[model samples]
Target chain A: MIASVGNVLVWMVWVGAATACLASGIAVVTLTNPFFSALGLIGNLSSLAVLYLLASAEFVAAAQVLVYAGAVMVMFLFVIAYLGGRADAPWAGGSKLFRIAAVVTGGALLAETLVALLWKSSRLSHSAAVGPTFGSPAEIGRSFLTDHLLAFEVTSIVLLVAAIGGVVLGIQPSPEEETTA
Target chain B: MSALFLAATTEPWWISLIKAAIIINIVLVTFAYLTLAERKIMGRMQLRYGPNRAGPFGLLQPIADLVKLVRKESFFPAAAIDVLYIFSPFIAAFAALSTFSVIPWGPGWHIGGYYVTGYVANVPIALILIFAVGSIGIYGFIVGGWSSDSKYALLGSMRTCAQLVSYEVSLALSVLGVVIMSRSLSLVDIVDRQYHEWWYLPYAVPQFVGFVVFMLAGTAETARAPFDLPEAEQELVAGYHTEYGGMRFGLFTMAEYINLITLSGLAVTLFLGGWHIPGPWLQAYGPIWFLLKLGALIFVFIWMRATLPRLRYDQLMRFGWKVLLPVATLNAVITAIVVVAV
Candidate 1:
């Protein structure tokens, strides 16, 4: 009885979080104001993090909130605020071709999702069994260091390159200064 | 009730709920008194009585302030974004309150059939969760400022975002040494390791550099004095919440104080041996030791506010990125090497 109750609670949480994630994802694209759109994106990211938590991926869930919703979205808000009232609505003035391409891409994604859901529906019934410590920080750290060591190192190097590129771009001399030099 | 008192790990939902309710009330009451305590301490430091009229040594000042704030007119800006402007404070307060849940305040014990764990939740990633929730709390300030439609608020929010995001890196990095020594992200485990393996010595002794970096970064992360560029009232005229009035404004301040208390609690848990005294005899009085240590940290926070001046924006940025970040990284690297060797 207790196990059933726990299962029900988990199911309820998953449903609630999934609904919120979908609603917020829609709101991100549909919101007209740039700032509100950013807020919607944050909401979406946060709900996605909740979903990650529900999936028992605790470390990933925390990192999602800490990195994307916390740091990256704050930068997005900063840029939006810097633009002030002059920031354009995301979908307002795109070219007709661009809009067509967007619609086509969205349609393709929808169709692909439908195909995956219907054709692979049987696969969703059973999940792979794992240890209780799966998705924990220690477990993830161990896997990253051992099994995925090369990939992890490559990712770090890529991040380092991005940081260096950002600094270089930020420190470039103005045209007038360059001419004077 | 006896049946419900299972092991801490297997406690029923209602038990967790009860614990959460108790913890929330304790935190809220502490936050209320912390304001008065800050004022009284500041007054004494500056040689004057602070709010003596509010019922003897300003004991009732927080209640008075609450009543005044609730009764005051909540002025809404004409140009403000209504939904987000109002929602931001709740988000801020909620995030601040939730971050405390995973913080273990004492060692677990059994009384008859009742097992009580100090924290509401024993999250494996409690340390990371604190930073995560804190990041979400930043939204309250940023969104509040952005929605206010005021220049000062906008600028203040911008500084808050930049400062918080920048300092958070160093703050998280500074705790790497602790994580390395304890070999766990759980606060309970960290405290347990400190008590057992380290022979009652906290990580603060071996990881002195990390402790200093953590304290500095924590102060900056919470946007306290000497690093309070976000709400530098001398220039920004109340900063991000300039347009906020009444209970909304009160919520923002409440969130700030609660975050301060939570940070202090975290510092105690991480660097002050948590609820453990040096001897085995006083182990039963865990909560009292925890409270005393927590109070000392809070006092240090207030004392720093009274003693130090706020940093200039450039200096703040440079210090965070250049000094704190590099030092924290170096400390982490050395600690990792030492941990591996020994």
Candidate 2:
């Protein structure tokens, strides 16, 4: 009886969190104010973290908050705040042709997702029901270090290169720009 | 008798709720006293009396401050984002308090047939959850600043966002060393790992550099004195919450104290052997030992606040990214190598 109750409660929590997540995602696009949009993004990210928890992907959920909602979103807010009035700049700068192309590209991506969903219904519905040991940090660490070692190393290299590139590009100005100024 | 009844019931959800309430109340009361403690300690450090007038050595000072703040008028800017401006401080306080849910205060206690752990939630990623919730707190400052419609507030928020993001890197990397050593992410498991070792063999010995980096990054992350460039009184006037008044400002202050306590708690748990008393005699009183360790770490926090001067903006950024990050990364790499080899 207690086990059934616990399972029901978990499902209820999952439903509530997933709904909030979707609502926040909608708010992110619908909110005209850049700051509000960013706020919506935070809400979406956090609720998604809650959903991750419900799914028992505890480490991934925490990382979702730490890296995406926390650090990355803060940077987005920082830039929005720094730019101030410019954050609300109109999309008129983009040509009509460019806007049309963007819309078409978005629609194509949406259609592709829909087609994939319909084609792989059974596999998609499985929800990746992992075993008891699957989402544990130690398990993830072992798999990363051994089974996916190349991908892990490559990711680190990519991040390192990106960091160095950012530092180089940010610190020293181009000679042409310096001379022009 | 209550424990006996509870044991027979097998009602974890209700018991967890009760535990949550107890923990929250304890934390809130402690937060109130912490402000008083900081003032008194800081006053002594600076050679002055601090708030001695309010009910016997300022014991009632936090209460008095709360009353005053509650009675004061809440004023909002004319052209501000009203909803968000109103919402930010509550978010800050909420985020700060929620970080405690996963933090194990001591070993599990068995009363009658019921078993109870110190923490509300004992997820596998307890440490990372602390970091995750802590990161969300930056939004409170950002939203509060952006919505304030003041130049100083905007600038302060921008600085806070940058500083927090930069330091969070070092903070997370520093913890990687501890995670490598403990081989588990649960706070309780980490503490248990320290039980077999003597006092000095605390992860601090192997990850001394990480500890230092964690402390530095934590200080910066919390926006305490020395790393308090976000709300520098000399320049930003009150920083992000400059336009806030009354209970709103009080909430921000309350959140700051809670964050301070959380950091101190983390430091104690990760590096200071948590609730494990050194000698055999005191081993049974795990929760008491845990509180003592937490108090000592909090004192170090207050001591640093009283002594250290705020770092310059440029210097703060440079230290976080250029120095702390690399050092933490190196510490993690070395610890991983050694742990693997062993």
Candidate 3:
């Protein structure tokens, strides 16, 4: 009885989270308020965090909550606040084109989901045999060090460029803006 | 409701709920007091008296402050983004509190002769899940800043995003040294690795480097001292929190402390063997010893905040990528060699 009740509650939270995520996705695109748009993104992101914990990816889950939700969101909020008083450039009338594009994209997404559902049986048998690589952090580490070494190398280059870019962007126009004004 | 009650009636269920509540309370209280201790310690270091008047050397200051905050009027900004603004605090608090769930609090506290291990989940990827939670938590800041409708708040949010993303790379890489050396991500298994040959000393030189880098980056990720450009008072005027007041402000402060606790705990776990008490013949009370170790770790964070100056924004960026990033990658490479060669 206890197990059954616990299971039910867990399922409820899972389903509720999925619904919230869907709602957030809709709200992000539909909302006029930039504030509401960011908020919706938070909801979607946080649900993904819970889903990580549920899936037994504990380290990734915690990292998700900390880096993405905790830290990145804070930065996103800063941009919103810093730009708060500034009005956005007026929207041009490509929304009808956007609607037509949305229809094409939406139809494609629907067709993809439908195909995914139809392909479930064939895909099930064809799924790659995952090794006993789940629990071992060392395996993940080795993978990072070996097979993903090129990616690792590129990650360093990206970070180096990003650091330089950040400093450059952070610079205030070489005192040129100040002199002109 | 009654269904919950019905589930609560199971013998083990009753104990489980009790244990959960106790753990949760312990984590929350630790967070609350750590802030006061940090403030007081930093105050003394800065040649000023901290909050020493409230109760017997200001120990009760957190409690007193909590009461005042609770009574204060929560001023919701009129132009606020509604849903996310109202509940971002809860989300922040929840994420901080949940990170403790996988922690092996104590070696299976005995109950009725069936050795009950004191952990909520013993998954293989507990460490990864912990990191994942941190990732999700970034949204709270973004949401809070946007919802506030303040320029300062938004700028702080953007800084937070950039800081966390940069620092997280170094932070994650630094830990690869330990994970490779120890061969497990499970905190339990990591502790077991320490039993025979201590991880700290064998890879002492590299581990220390990793530890320092992780601490520096982690502190920035948590928006703490030295890397607190996001919330720099003179600059952004409280950064993302420029608009919050009362308990809403209180919640943000509470979240900071919680983040501090989580970072310290992670440090202790990864570099310090978490709750694995040092010294032999004292392993029985390893749990108590572990708490003491964590306490000591938290104390040092406070000490650093008191002593160090905040980093310049450019310097902060440089330190992470130029210095820490390459060193961390080197540590990972060396660790892989050591593991494979062995």
Candidate 4:
């Protein structure tokens, strides 16, 4: 009886987190004020981190909070604060063609998800059960050093390139460039 | 029935709740005295008496200050966002308290036929868990500043956002060296690894560069003096909390000290062999040793506040990104190489 109760509590918490995740995600896109939208994005990211923990991906959940919610969202909010928290123009005032394109894209996504759910998607089904080591940092470290070494190295290179690009774009003009201009 | 339920469960939930309440209350009382300690220490450093009037040797100062703050009227600027202006400081305090949950206060002990751990929760990724929660506290500064609708407050918050994000990289990298050496993400496991080592072999010895970087980055991360551009009194007039007053303002002040204590505790856990006294018999008194290391770190924090001058904003950014980050990364790489070679 106690074990069953514990299992029920887990599922309840998971459902609550999922609901919060979806609500905050909708708020992110729908909030008129950019600052509030950014806050909504943070809420969304944090709830997703909880979902990741529920899925037993503790390391990934930590990364989600550390990198995305903590760093990336702060930068986003910083930019928005400088710009002033102006509400976006109403959707009706936007270009008709742009609205149509957005609607079409959203509709397509909705249709794909519905079809997959209703038809019992084979690609989504997997027989193998996750083991004790699954999603653990040691498992990740092993894969990174062995099976996924090439991809890991490539990702680092990509990050390096991005850093360089950021520096090149953000730096002030040198004395020579200023003089020339 | 309750007995059967307790037998079936791995976690003794009631005991954990009791422990959490004990820890939280202790932290609250500590936060109160830390303010008194900071002022008294700063006063002594500058050759003057600090708050000696409130009871003998200023022992009652924190309680007196608490009462004074509670009695004062909370002034909300007309221009401020009513909701966030009030909510921000709560978030600040909440973040600090939440991070305390994962901290292992000491090894487990048996009492009344039941075993009890020192901490509330001993999660697998306790180290990163603290960082994740600590990062959310940044929102408090940002929201507090931005919601105030004052130019100085806005500028202060923006400075805080930039400064914290910059130093966070070095802070993360510095601890990466320790995590690499321990081969574990749990703080308890890290402490266990250091138990058998000699006195001279703290993780800080091998990763001295990382230690230096950690201290520098940590100063910036916590917005301590020298990196406290966010509330630079000379320039921005108390910065983010300029518009805050009464108990609301007190919360932010309390939150800073709370962060100070938590960070010092973490530094002890990561570097000073966490709660481990040398001899076998003395080992049972782990909590005392933990407090000793934690107190020493707090004293250093206060000492630095008294000794150092605030850095220029641009210079602060330069140090974090250009100096600290590269050095920390190099230290991590070297540590990794040695770990692999051995």
Candidate 5:
């Protein structure tokens, strides 16, 4: 009876988080204000983090909030605030053809997701059993060092290159400034 | 009387709820008195009596302040975004309050036939969880400033955003040394490792560099004096919450103090061997020791505020990125190498 109650609670949480994720994801694109859109994105990321916690991937869940919802979104808010009145609404002036293309692409992705969900649900009645240390930091660190070593190194290099690119872009003289110089 | 000891994971849900209730109240009371203490201490430093009129030695100051704040008219700026302007303080307070949940206040003890852990929740990634919740707290300042529709508020939030983001890197990096030595991210495990180590010394000795960087970065992260560029009063007129009044403003203040308390608690847990006394005979009074250490760290925070002048904006940025970040990174690297070798 206790196990059944626990299962019911877990299901309730999963459903609530999933619904919030979808709602916020839609809100991100639908919101007129840039700040609101960013807020929506944060909401979406946070709800997704909740889902990750529900899945018992505690490290990934925390990283999702720390890196994306926290650091990256703050930067986005910073830029939006800096731009202030000049920041235009997303896709506000896009061509009709572009909007159509975006819709088509979104529809395709949604269909693919639905199909995959159905396929997976048919194959497995419950989530696959994970080992005791499956999502622990130590296990994750070991996996990154051994099984995913190359991928990990590549990711670091990519991040380094991105940082350099950002610095270069930031230092570049604007067109008007260059002409004067 | 039967007694049963339970691990953090095995404890029942109601027990966790009880722990949460107790912790929240304790933290809130501490926060209320901390404001009073800060004022009194600062007043003493500057050669003035602070709030002596309120309930003898200003014991009732916090209560009086609460009453005034609650009763005051909550003035909203005409151009402010209503939804976010109102929601931002709660967001900030929520982040600050939740970060305390994972902080283990003491070693677990059996009480009345039940084993109760020190913390509300003992997740595997408790350390990262604190940072994650803290990051969310940044949004409160940012959103509050933006929603207020004031340039001063906007600039304040911008400064807050940049300062916090820059300092967080060094702050997280500085703790890597401790995580390496302990080989676990859980606060309880870290404290346990410190207690059980052969030398009986906290990580503060071996990872002194990390400890210094952690404290410096923590000061910046909490936006206290010397690093409080975001709310530099002369420049920004109270910064992000310039337009906020009444309880709305009070919430922001509450969040800041709570975050300060949480940071001190974390420092004690990470560097000072939380709740661990040198002698085995004093083990039963673990919570008292924990509180004593936590209070000392908080006093240091207030002392720093009284002592140091605020840093210049450019100096703040330069110090965080150039000096603190490099020192933290280098310390982490050296610690990792030494750990691997020995």
Candidate 6:
């Protein structure tokens, strides 16, 4: 069998990075200030990007960084600001409900990871049976255009409407009473 | 799956270490000089010599700046949230640094007959990860603003968050055309498809609207001019990092250049036939040729910064939602039709 050593290191880094991200993700909700929580989430995300890199997912890692780290958190920041939530934060302590939710979610994640680890080899490799390549750029592009064309069109229309809505919202002054005060 | 099954296998740690070192060095060196180049160009644009004394024609300026920043005292805002105030820059820097792992700087050429991937990450979804990192970067701006504990900083960072989130969809969707045309998420694969014919001019032509959206939003993404409302120095006295001095501030500064370089690299890879040296005559230039192409893309970024006036906050938001986003969608639709038919 034609074998190479790239596999072991990839798995090790991939698992290590995923662990770091999940650990930090837990810290996000645990952290005191919303700002710190946001920072923790960013830490969690970067680790995930690193994990993606380790998996030989070149495009996904870049997109992970660009869209999630670059764009999505921007939304979080905007939402945090528009709310004008309190900046003075006390040390964070979980409520009974959050702790329970965390435990349940944590259990689910562990179960999934266990399955993934055991079935790792089968799931890891992609076959080129469909064509000369699996997930080749050309094939993905054609599929996106042909098979998923309707969804693509719909996404565009939705974005267009959203853009118009944002403009309309921005132009309208906050209900006069708030502005006057 | 073939890529993943190899996990049971292992490579020499030294080779892996060398590759990791390469990734780190590229980001740091690129960020350092991007600042120097921006200054030199901006200086020339305004008809003045910039950093001439630093090193012959300011070649040594970025090196000097790096030393100065490292030696400078790191300070946190007194009234700020102590720990996060300190951590925001690293969060920013790390978010910025991770974007480079997937970039295909050149073809995995055989150096001494040893085939190399030429990238740190050779994954199935490289582009998605890039955008994801970009999203995380928003948290840095938000944290910096909130940690600064100042109204101006808060407002600035808040603006950044909003702008990036809104603009990113259009950016992603716009580039999806390239994804559709190229069918691969790996930037290397994208470039491979383009080597025969540049995707930008043929398939990506109609998708220029996305490019416009991407460029504008990406400009905002890095928190740079016109879209640079997050750190609107004139208004916020440096926005999110207003309270930061020394090394903390250096992180913010470095993050800006890194974002710029990363964006340009992505742009070149997706739309500009990354590392595909132009000219049938120039094919011999090889990877160095791609570096040259990257240089030109970087120059355009600095050029836009110098030429374009800063966008008003309201105008920035309005343009994104009203102008770029709609145009991007329209472009995507049109390109899909043309691409499918062809």
Write model 2 residue lDDT over B1-342, tens digit each, in one string.
111122224446777788889988888998999999999999999999988999988899999999999999998999888988999999999999988876777767887788877667766677887888888887788888889889988888888888888888889899998998888888877877866654535677777898888888999888998899999999999888899999999999889899988888888888888777655566658778878888888888889999999889999988887888889989999999999998
TM-score (chain A only) for the predictions, listed in order: 0.89, 0.80, 0.73, 0.86, 0.88, 0.63
Ranking by DockQ: 1, 5, 2, 4, 6, 3
Clash-forming residue pairs, model 1:
none
What does the lDDT read for residue B307 in candidate 4?
Answer: 99
Best by DockQ: 1
Candidate 5 residue lDDT tens string, B1-342: 000111244787788888888999999999999999999999999999888888988899999999999999998999998999999999999999989988887778888899987778776788998999999999999999999999999999999999999999999999999999999998888988898983567888888999999999999999999788888999999999999999999999999999999999999999988888765667767889889999999889899999999999999999998899999999999999999999
Docking class of 6: acceptable
**DockQ numbers for every candidate?**
0.52, 0.47, 0.33, 0.41, 0.51, 0.36
Share of reference contacts found in each model: 0.61, 0.67, 0.57, 0.39, 0.63, 0.63
lDDT of 6 by residue, B164-187 (tens): 677777787778778777766767
**Model 5: runs farther than 4 Å from truth?**
A85-90, A172-181, B1-9
Task: List the lowest-lDDT window of 10 residues for candidate 2 chain B.
Answer: B1-10
- Give TM-score, chain B, model 1: 0.96
Clash count for each candidate, listed in order shown: 0, 0, 71, 0, 0, 76
**lDDT score, candidate 3, position B84:** 68
lDDT of each: 0.88, 0.83, 0.72, 0.85, 0.89, 0.71
lDDT of 4 at A63: 84
Tell me each candidate's RMSD, in Å, in order.
2.9, 4.1, 5.8, 3.3, 3.3, 6.0
lDDT of 3 by residue, B1-342 (tens): 222223224346556666778888888898788878788778888899899888898999999988998899877778876676877777677777777766665666677865556565555666776776666566667667766777788787777767877887888898888888777777666666665576333233447877887887788878878788889888888987788888888887777788777787777767776555555555557568668877887887777776788999999888888988899899889878977997
- Candidate ranking (TM-score, best to worst): 1, 5, 4, 2, 3, 6
> Can you list the residue pairs that collide in candidate 4?
none
- Candidate 4 at A14: error in angstroms? 2.1
- i-RMS, every candidate? 6.6, 7.7, 8.0, 6.7, 7.6, 4.8
